[model samples]
Target: MLLNCDLGESFGAWKMGLDEQVMPHIDLANVACGFHAGDPDVLAHTLSLVKQHQVTLGAHPSYPDKQGFGRRSMQMSEQSLTNTLHYQIAALEGMANVQQLSVSYVKPHGALYNDMMNNPQLLKWVLQAVARYSRSLKVMILATAEQDKHRELAHKIGIDLMFEAFADRLYTDEGLLTPRSQPNSVHNKQALLQQVSQFHDDNSVTTNTGKRLPLVADTLCVHGDNEASIMLIQDIKQLLNT
Candidate 1:
């Protein structure tokens, strides 16, 4: 039932969500590296805040596309993808070292994450990069009911895996997240709370189409960009505590 949020996304000229206010309620903070959104100063500030709040720190790396905020997919060769991930992870590790904090996990951001779910080659490359850097750092991934080959590969490579579920997103009957392009992809605060409560109660969730789906996750993700996201996160924390 650990709650995590994507934060530290503010780039040089552009600003993002309120990390200071949100940090107090989140148990884990996924700080974005420079690839998607964030700079050295922002990462340093985020690390300090996470340390102050005693929240676990995770590295959020994405394809090198700051223009689209890493949401858009980019065609990258295997070598390029591996090198990019290594660079992003290294940058965050450096910042964490300077703050006397360690990165506890790695969560691929935006398109890169979705790509890894279906692309075995990409998943292997990403896992290799993570293992090469540090096998102790856990890789957070969306939970799927069927046996996940990538998850098995991660474990075989000596990297810890943290299965994650989204609190504010809808899922299909096939154990995959509803596509964002669809109308039912996102959920309101009350709906999200209800789903989370059901998950806590029965370890299952009802999809938008009223299909009961079993889900087991070690961590839940709450996106920071949504306007109502902060309220939803607060409600989730309150409910989980109760």
Candidate 2:
């Protein structure tokens, strides 16, 4: 399993994740674009760290909601949403190009990511945006235990989709991630290790309801905002390697 983290989320004076320490431990870095919490300087610095660590770079795009931190959902037309996605991704890709690095994957941030998974129309537009950027750029989405509508749409769109499982997020009874607003949405260290161990054993995640939800995924994500997650990321790496 490939370990990944959201990076470059820090805005001007406000620093977010510990990209310096976290980049060295993960296989993929989902660098945030300017829309959510990243500025030009932050993106450049983050890219440098990613390049130094030789980690794979991915575009982390979100709605044009910086104040909300891209966590709140918005009502948007399909064309507008498509344009927003393309623009944010292109911004990151453009920066990466100048630095002699290329973005290999695309992952939507917060609400946009959640919207795409549940709304087929929105997912199509997002996929369309991805195809517009690069046919080969793989889009990352949450992996479900059972049926994944997003996967089917991505296959039809002809762009590769990479399924992702979270180490810190809580899962619902239906194998979907519980809404972050709910209590216990974030996992404790013990629960996290248990989930990772299960995935490391086979590609399955134990849901909150105590069911072994089968999750076939390509990458594992740990939010970089948590300072304690650095240790969790290391522990997960150790578990996976062992």
Top TM-score hit: 2
Per-residue lDDT tens digits for candidate 1, residues 119-159, read 77787788778878744688888787653665678878878
The lDDT for every candidate, in the order shown, is: 0.84, 0.86
Write one digit per residue (lDDT tens) for candidate 2, span 58-120: 999999999999988999887888888888888998999888999899999999998877776
Tell how far residue 161 is off in model 2, in angstroms.
0.6
TM-score between model 2 and native: 0.95
Which segments of model 2 are wrong by more than 4 Å? 146-148
Candidate 1 Cα outliers beyond 4 Å, as residue runs: 147-150, 225-227
lDDT of 2 at 34: 88
Q: Clashes in model 1: which pairs?
A: none
Output the lDDT of residue 26, model 2. Answer: 91
Candidate 1 versus truth, CA RMSD in Å, comes to: 1.7
